[model samples]
Structure formats: structure tokens, C-alpha cells
Target: MASETDAPVDGVLIGEEATPIDLTEQAEVADASFAQVSQVQTVINHIHGDIGGASFGISGSRTKSRRTSGPVSGHEMAEARTRYERHESYEAAAQQLGRCNMVALIGTAGTGRRTAALNLLHDFVGGRREVVVELSPAYTLEKLATREYRKAHGYLLCDWPKDDVDGSIADFHLREIRRRVRDAGAYLVITATATSLPAGDQILWQPPPARDVLLAYQVAPEIAAEAAAHITPEHAMADVVALARDLAAGAPLDQALGRLESAGRRDVVAWFDAPRSRGELFEMAAMAFTAGLPEASFESLLARLESIAGIGMEKADAVSADDPMPSRRLLRVAEGSLFSLSPGRRLEFKVASHRTHVMRELYQRHGMRLWEPVIEWLHECAALRDNPSAQAEVARGVAILASVSDYSYVDSTFLTPWARGNGVMRSQATAAMAVSWLCLDETTRSEVLRTVSSWTRASAARPKFTATLAWSGELGIRFPLEAVRMLWLQIRNSEKPVRHAEIALARLFAALTEATGNALPMLDWVARQISNDKRIGRAIDPLIRAILSVLSARADGVGIPTVTAHLRTRPDSAVPLAKLWSAVLVKRPHRRDALAALYDAVCAFDERDDDDRDHVRALFAALVEALPAKERPLLAHDLRRYAISRNTDENRLEILLSLLRVFLSPAVLSLDTIGKHP
Candidate 1:
């Protein structure tokens, strides 16, 4: 039923001829990618039991139900009340909240601002029948005005959107919300950064002494004082709390603090050494790879993990029942789970730092005992086209594993197979995303670049395709010039040209031009490539088509095309423009579109400023000069005919015609042309 290329190679399916996926705008892609990385870091901070950070999400109607209905869990409220240490501004903030029925807590991150909000609410509702509900960060004054509030309840809303914190908030909107709270006999406390609020509305809160925080957690006074000595101002309250727990458990002061400094390495070691059943181990391994994925996706991955471990569902069920700890308790103890910003709940480790450690430990201690099966499972995950976000997370997990484990082993086991084996665009995307993430760390960037460079030269189509995706997406966006060079190498050296690579080059050039508002760097690169006699011969058609695509690309709100804007600012771009146009006109496929683009750019230059005429003249002269002597007259004739057909102005037409004649003169036409000059 399937072609040879579509069949499985080893465990991975080969899809070298797979169609490329459509790329979204670079800004959107960058935001999603950055959020993925940020979420990973947030999970890692959870290793220290930090609660200050929340999952990333944009406010939308889909999240409105979750935002409004969920109350702050009782455990969270109890923990906050027990551990909260009053800051210098606590009394002032409490007084404000009691008086106005609302107070905004403002401070930098990791300063216990959220905890302070919870505690303030707790004290306000003391001896009263009330619940503390955390309103969504997306909550607004309008919602406050409209929604019915339960009498005597305390509300906490952390990290309110900054855009909503404008001058109106200090005036009418704040007054209105205050009126609503007072009328309902309820108290509200909103936490935000100082920058997000008006100076008058900000009740500045600073973290209290670390010793005070440790003592509040019921640590021995002597140990608390001693541990506080090691705590820097930059240390979050969460980290201090974690340290206190260790001290209460009889850990040495130095070793307890050392664990905090060591990114949960000691904890990870302890976790593996004390682990229980096969099911729990498999679940941890699955979570290590699938954190931040939806619950259904996570369950799917868990099933796959069991299959890879040679544990049948029937056996797994028996093992689960036989285990002393319940599945729910095990989930809490082994892997910390949380709901993602997306609609469904997602799973994540309680201590995200343990994720990297788990991955590295499995590879080191288990070796092929786990790596081979994990690799095969990843290929199966990559083949699933329905859940791209899940696929991307899998790739990110691998990149994290690669960061801590043997780079060569991880590369060979996962990236190389996915890149060379699957023609699936999603699989290639997985490889590309992994490569991009690896490139983020300076320590691994060189090796990643070197490996990807070699892939561009690979004889297999899938490898080249994967490399093209990397160069076009995050890699190209971050390193435009180098991306251009590598992409050019792929295009030139291939026995036959790759259309996707050419399109990627055009897209890269267009994105850079739009972002920087200057196309000189890209234009310069194109000029150099076009100037090369041998290289240009091998890649002439794709090069010309790519140039045409870049010229035709439009930026939002810009009246002129990309090329017109470039020539207007940097007249020197005309040389490259000429060389590119000369090649385009000589190629039959792109000739008509090239002529239209040239005429449009010329007309645009004329309409804007008379000073642009010199650049236009130079562009025409060089374009004609770069063509064969026999073709120069024909190109000049075509240009004149096209301009007149578009009803060119008589004076401008005369100038263009005169310039064309001079450019087409025998001496000028005798100048060297690109390659063999057709």
C-alpha cells in the first residue's frame, strides 16, 4: 500500500518526499516557542516548591469558566497563612485593605507578593464565614462590576494585566470596584508589579527577613538563624521554605543548602534510589518526556511507555493494584501534575529540575535498557499528526535530555533517526525544534550548528528537509546571515535544486527585511552569491526565483514593495538588484513577473522622491550590462513596451528610454554577465 520511501526504516518511517508544512508568521512562532521554553523553566523552579510563577496563557473566552469558578485550594490557603512573614509594608497594606475594601500589592517577582495577598485576605476575613477565591489574572474592573460576589468572601487576583492598569484605574474604575466590594461586604487584594499600577494605588511590599520566614515554618530557632545566613536577598521565599523542611527532617545545614544550590540533583538521586514499582518508574519516565502536555496526550504517552517496557495492560493493571501506594498518591509523590493554560489539564513534575535528572539518569544507569525503547516510542509519537503541540513538547524534552546527557548519543539515537527516517513534516518539525532549542545554550550551539551543517550535505532528502526547516524557522530568524549562507550551501550543492530550501531563503530574507526595516545585509549577501561565477551557474534558477519572491514580499502598512523601500534608502542595493533582475529576465519562467516587479519598483521610486531616479537609472544600466549583448536589446525593448503599456508619464518614460538606450550601447553591453550569459 505504501511506497518504499513511505515504509518504516528500523523503527522510524521514511518520508523523504513528504510535503512541507505551512509556516505561520515568525512573531507568532517565536512567541509560542519562547512560551514553551519559559514553561519548562517555570517547572524547574517548582523543584524548589516555588509557587510565585503561574502557567503562561493569553486571556480568552475559553479560559473564562476556569478563571471565574475555581477557588484557591484550601491547602494553598492554609500553607500561605502558616508560612507568611509580614514585610515592612504589611501593616500599611492591611490598613488600606480594611479601609478601602481593596488594596493592590506591588513588588518585583519572588518577593512573596502573592503570599502577602493571601495572608492579607485571611486576616481581613478572620472570625468571619468566608472563602478566599483567586480570581484569574485576566480579571478586569468590568467583571468585578458585573459579577455577583459572595458576601464576606476575600478575593485574590495576582498579576493583573498591565494594560488595564492605566490612569482610569486611579480614577473612576478603582472607585467603582471599591464601591462594589464595600457594597458586598467583601475584601479584595490584587497583586502586580510596581510598573503595572499608578504610584498612588501601589502599596509597595518587600520580602521580610529570611530568618523570619524560616521561623514561621516551625524550624528550630538556631537552625533557622543559621540557614538564614546562607540565604541571599535574591533567594525566593519558596526556596527558604524548602530549606526549612530539610532542616526539620534532620539534614545538615550545609547539605540542606547544598541541595538548594545544586538544582535538585541530590533529590533526583534519592528519588531514583528509593523508587518502587515498574509502573511508577515507567510513569516517571513518561512524565519526563511529556510534561506540559494535555492529560489525554499524557495518558497516550503513558500507554506507549508501558508497551515499550514490555508490560502489557493486564500486567500493568495487576502491578498498579499490588503497589502499596495508590495511583493518585503516587502521582503526587513521583510527578507533580498541573493544568496547562490550554483547555484540558496537563501533567508536570512537582520538581521540574528532576525531569532533566530523570532523563540523564535513565540514559546513564539504564543505557540501552531504556534508551532504545524511548527512541522507538518517540518515533511513534512523532508519527501522530493530530497533536502537534504534544509532538513539539516531546522534541523539547529530548533537547533538555541532550543538554544533560551525552550529546552524541542523544543526537544519534533521536535527532538523526527522526531527520533521516521520516518524511512526515511533523517529524521533521520535531527535529528542527529540537535543534533550535539545543542552539539556545551557548555550550551546545557550536556542536548543534556543526551537526546541522553536515545534515544539509546529506544525500537523503529527509535530512536536508529537516535542516531546511531549522534554517527557515528559529535558526534563520536568530542568525539571518549565517542562515542565508547555510541555506545557500544546501541549495548549491544538491545534485538537483530543492524548492523548499529556495522558498525558505526567500522567507528568511523577507522576515529580516520586515523586522530590521533595512534589506542591505540580505541584498549584500545575494549580490556576493550572484557575483560568484561557478556557484551561480549551479543555482541560477532558484536564486532568481528567490530574489523575485523577496522583492514581491510586502510588509504590513508599507505602501512600497520591499525592493522599492530598500533602493530608496540604500542606493547601493541597485547593483545587486540589477544582477538579480538580469538573471530573472534571462530565465523564461520568472521573466514576466520579474519585469512587472521591476516596473512597479521603478514607478514607486519615481512617485516618492525625485532623488531616487539616480538609483533607478543605475539599476537599469547595471541590469542591462549584466545580460548578454544579444539579449540586452531584447530586454530593453521589453522594458519599454511594458512601461508604455502601463501608461507611463511622458517625461519619466523619456528618461527611462534614454537610460535604457545608454545601457544597451555596445560598450556597456560588452561588460561581463553572470555565468555564461545565456
Candidate 2:
């Protein structure tokens, strides 16, 4: 089999940015069959705290030890598929394909109405793979697609072979197909309008989103300059500056706008093109009137010009907030108001940009309290069926409430029926996670679980529920540990468990920090969780050792001088970053003296994605701090071989230089005699 080389991933993939709290591609692979999987060293991105740029690699083959939730009912779906000879041998192939990480069915889709029914059956019975049931037996292509949840992947496939429907169906499916591979890890291959059944797993082909495009805009930069020639203006730079002063000093911006509105332009297009100081507006208007163009069209021309690209607007009439922050509710911009300290610099107007402008405005004016009432009003408006912005209002409301950790009060008026059905539940998985930790009666807790379960999609219930259960164990909730153990047993094979587990751990850590003001204790506690694993040390031993190393070196020392900053973040047993870091300093061949080898390891780990950089830095910090002062010079020298630091040189050269310094030191080594140790 051919190896999967470095393939481009879709979306702004994890680890692309700095300060990621997730997994990154840190190391390389040299193992056969999997060598390529790890060879392409990439930055590790943390997702919901699961670190895995490399671990993100999908390992094929079904997990052998875990049981399927519903049944091995792929057999039943296969049987239904064979009934019409439309998809024969459903059982023979479905049964033979045991423990496949994914399973998919391919057949020539026609206008068969039963196609959807068949696909649903395949999913309900044996959903270890992607299944599509749309042969489009009836109705138009668009109609069928819109009616049913026609996702590209996720145990569902839809096909249309009629008329090509002007190719819109293909385009629509293409988006979902690409989404399947990127978002959910389902590989997709659309046959366009063709309906030939294919052999197993033949659709490992790449999706279009995986291909890179030149991010530079196709429109040339010079186009704006070319277009800037046409707009005429009524405003002069100086006049605009004065106008901005009055408005920013608490004069209503609309008042200034009203003044412009009546200036009587005969509905013509004019643009000032220059900066919109009040003086500039006046100067430009004077120039336009002095010129041959009629002054009547000035306002109209100005409005149109302002709308066009590269044209200026006396846009900020109020001194709105300068920054754009989604969180920090009290922080907001005041539009049309001046904010600068200097008199002349005092200016009206502020930046007008926010995806959720309404909420942002409400926040600026009254912060969260008024925001609550505004959302209530929007909710009332939505109830009256008039507020089109209700959804956005509700979403912002949710964000505001969430930022404050008022999880119990999640706003529902903005939640779509579908959101209530699925999205909220996915989001709630974390918000309501405290329930697992909070002291509560088992009966009451069970009731809460049942209520939460009712809100989620049927498929999502167990995964979410199991995740919560694992969380409860991590929190040291006064429940039987067996419940936690059982939940793990149920989901050990599922793809989402580890992710949920990691999330649960993060929350558990947060709660501990809030209560104890420490992170080191979590290590000893982790031992309890891992020790309970039936497989004994096999499951969490590596994590135990790894977490221990990070914790052992943490600042629990006396006098508080050694106190580690950012106690909220600690190594999780799952990530075992210490082990990964130690590999750099460990044994290497020939060019592999311990320090030199460690330098190389640091280099390898350091060459990671942007998101992983901080984590790598943290690892570097921990490793250095862990060493005794006596060994610091030796280790620093070893680090010179590979560790690259932009501040001085790359990690290697820096480490190598430090090592040279140590060798040159009279107290450290006698460099004149190569064979002699210091």
C-alpha cells in the first residue's frame, strides 16, 4: 500500500496560531506502515485541549475490544439493501468488514424514494461507517436534499442522476462532502451524476478544501486606485475635522448627519476621497461647488462615495471604544464621540465594525445588565414574529451569560428548534459539566442526566452522558467509582471519549484551582483515576509518569519565590508532554552525547506549528527548570546543538555556543585536551 504523505488539511486547522492548549504535531515517525504519518513534523494544535497535530492522524481498522452501541445491525441494513438487488451482498460485505473504523455503501443512486429509508436503516443498524440512502426515487433533487438532513458524511450519502439539475445538487453536495472529511473525518467521493456501485473503501480520494489556494486576492491592489478616480466630494479634510470634534464631544452624530442630509444635493454621486476631518468635508464641498459640478448632488454623491471602496466617511461621530473584544462586556466603543486627550485630536466617531453590532451597542451603552433587558425585548419581538435580529441577540446573550459562567441560565429564546435539539446540547456538554462535580444526590444527579440526555440527539446522548460520567469521577464526586469505570468501558472505543475526558479534566483542574489555589495536587489525584483502570498500569502509567514529572518540578518550593505562574495549566495524564520533552535529552547515536542528543530533541520538538509554540516553550522552561543549578551549564551546552531561539540564534546554534562557552571556561573544562573531562 502506498503511504499517505503530507496532505493539506482543511479549515484554519489547529495549531496554526500561537498559544494553543491542544495537541500538536511534535515528533516524527519512523515505524513501518506509519512512518509517513509522523515524518512530516507539524505544529501541534490544541482542540478543546486535546493535543494532537500528529495524533489527529486517523488510525484505520475498528477497535476490537469495544461494543457497538445499537448493534452489529449493519447486517440488517445490508439485508434491506439486497432485497431489491439495488445493493446486493450487503450482509456478506458488511459482516465481513468487522471493526472497520468506518464503513460506507456505494450504489448507483437513481430516483428511488426508498434510498433515504435504506440509508437511515443502514445508520440505525450498523453505523460504524458512512452510509447514504439517497437514490432520489421521487421529488426534485433540491427538494429531497433540503427535506432530509443531507450531510455529506456521517453515515449518510445522497445521489442524484437526473438531468444533472444544472449541477447545483453536485455543488451543494460538494460543500457537505468537503465538510465531512474536514470536520468529521469521513472520507467522501461523489460520483457526480453517475450511479455505479464501487468496491470497498475506494473513495479515499482527497477533497477540494484540502488543496491550497493563493490567499492573495485575485483582484489587483491597483484596482482601488483606478476606481478612486471617479468619486467627487462635498467635504473638505479640515471642515470634517471640526464636525468630528462637535459630534465626539457629545453632540449626536445623527445631528451632524442630518445637517448633511438637508445640504440639498440633487441626488448625484460625489466623493471626498480624502480623510474625513470636518474641515476636509467643508473644503471638499467647497471645491466641488467651486468646480463645474452641481452642489445639489453633493449629499447623494457623498453617501454613495462613502459606500464605495477607498472612500472616507465622517464615519465615527462618536468616540466608541477603540478595541474589538467579544468578551469583557463592560468594554465597548462609543460611536460619534471624541476620546483623545488632546483638544484638536478629540474626534467624533469610532470604528463601526462588529459581527454582532446590536449586542455590542447595547453592551457599550449599559453593559450586561441592559443587555439582559435588550435580549428580553428581542425575545419578545421574536415571539411577536417581527424581530429578524432575534437570533443574533440571543446568541450574544448566551455569550454574555457564558462569559460570566452563569451556565444554568443559558438563554433559550434565541436557540433554534434545531439548536435545542443538538447544538445547545453539544455546547452544554461543558457548561453543565459542573453537575458531575457538584455534590448532589444520586437520584437528583441521575434526573439531571436524564434531562440533559432528553435534549441531545439520540446518537449523542451516550457519548455526552458517558463524558459527564467520566468527569464526575475526575472531580472526586461522592459517587461510586464504578459508575465512572463503567462509562469508560462503554465509550473506550468511541472516537469522542478522549476528547470529552480531556475537557472534563480541564474543568476539574479549574475547579481545583478555584478551591485550593494549586495545580500540583491534581497529579496525586490522577493516580487514583489511573489506578482504577482494570488493565492496571497499562492504560495510564505513561500519563502518570509524565504528569508526575511536570508536577514534580512545579514551584511548590518554600518562600513562594519558586511559585509557578499560571497554575491553571498543568500537564494532563493523557498528553504526557514530559516524556515527549525528555526524548530530546535522551540517548542518541554517535553525534548523540546526552546533551547533544537533548539539543537535537529540543530542536525536533521546537520545530512545531504556531499553536504548539507556547506549549513547546513551556516544555523547554520545565526541562531547564527541572535541572539542578550545577547541571544547568552542561544542559545548556547540550541544548546548543539543536534548540533554535530567534532571540539569539536557532536552538542548536545557541546551545552549541553555550556548550563552547562552558568548554572554554577554565573552571568547567580543559578544551586544550580533547580526551580530558572537566
lDDT of each: 0.63, 0.30
lDDT of 1 at 278: 71
Worst 10 residues of 1 by lDDT: 57-66
Candidate 2, run of 10 with poorest lDDT:
36-45
Report the C-alpha lDDT of model 1 over 1-678, residue by residue, as the tens digit: 123255333223256544333332233443333333333323322321333321111000011011122366565667677757776788889888878888887765556777788788888775333388766443456666667677889987765545434576546666677788899999888776533445655698777888887787688898898888877754555577778778877888888887563445556677677745777666767777777777766887878778887866565556655568646534443433321224446666555565666776676667666667777888887656667677777877887777666567768777777776533345666777777656443234445665666677665566666777676544554455667787877666655545667656665554445433445656778767766745443356666666676666543324677677777666777777777777678777777898898878777776344467666665765676567778877877888898899898887788667767754684543224211221
Instruction: Kindly list the per-residue Cα lDDT of model 2 for residues 1-678, writing each as its tens digit.
Output: 111122122123356643311111211110110111111111111111342111111111011101111112444346435323222233433332233323333332121222323443444333444343222122233443344333333333333233244455545753443444444433222222233223353232111110011011122234323322321232221123223344435455445443331132221111222234533333232222111122332233334333332233455564368845353111211232211112332211221111112222233333443334333433332222222122222222333332222222432323222122221122222223223322121112222333333332223332333334233322222222322333333334433223333323333333333323434434444445443445432343333333223332212111111112222144232123333333323312221333332333234433334423343344444444333445545555545433443333555454446444543343343223222322
TM-score of each: 0.49, 0.23
lDDT value, residue 252 of candidate 1:
86
Q: How close is candidate 1 to the true structure, as a TM-score?
A: 0.49
The TM-score that candidate 2 achieves is: 0.23
Model 2 clashing-pair count: 90
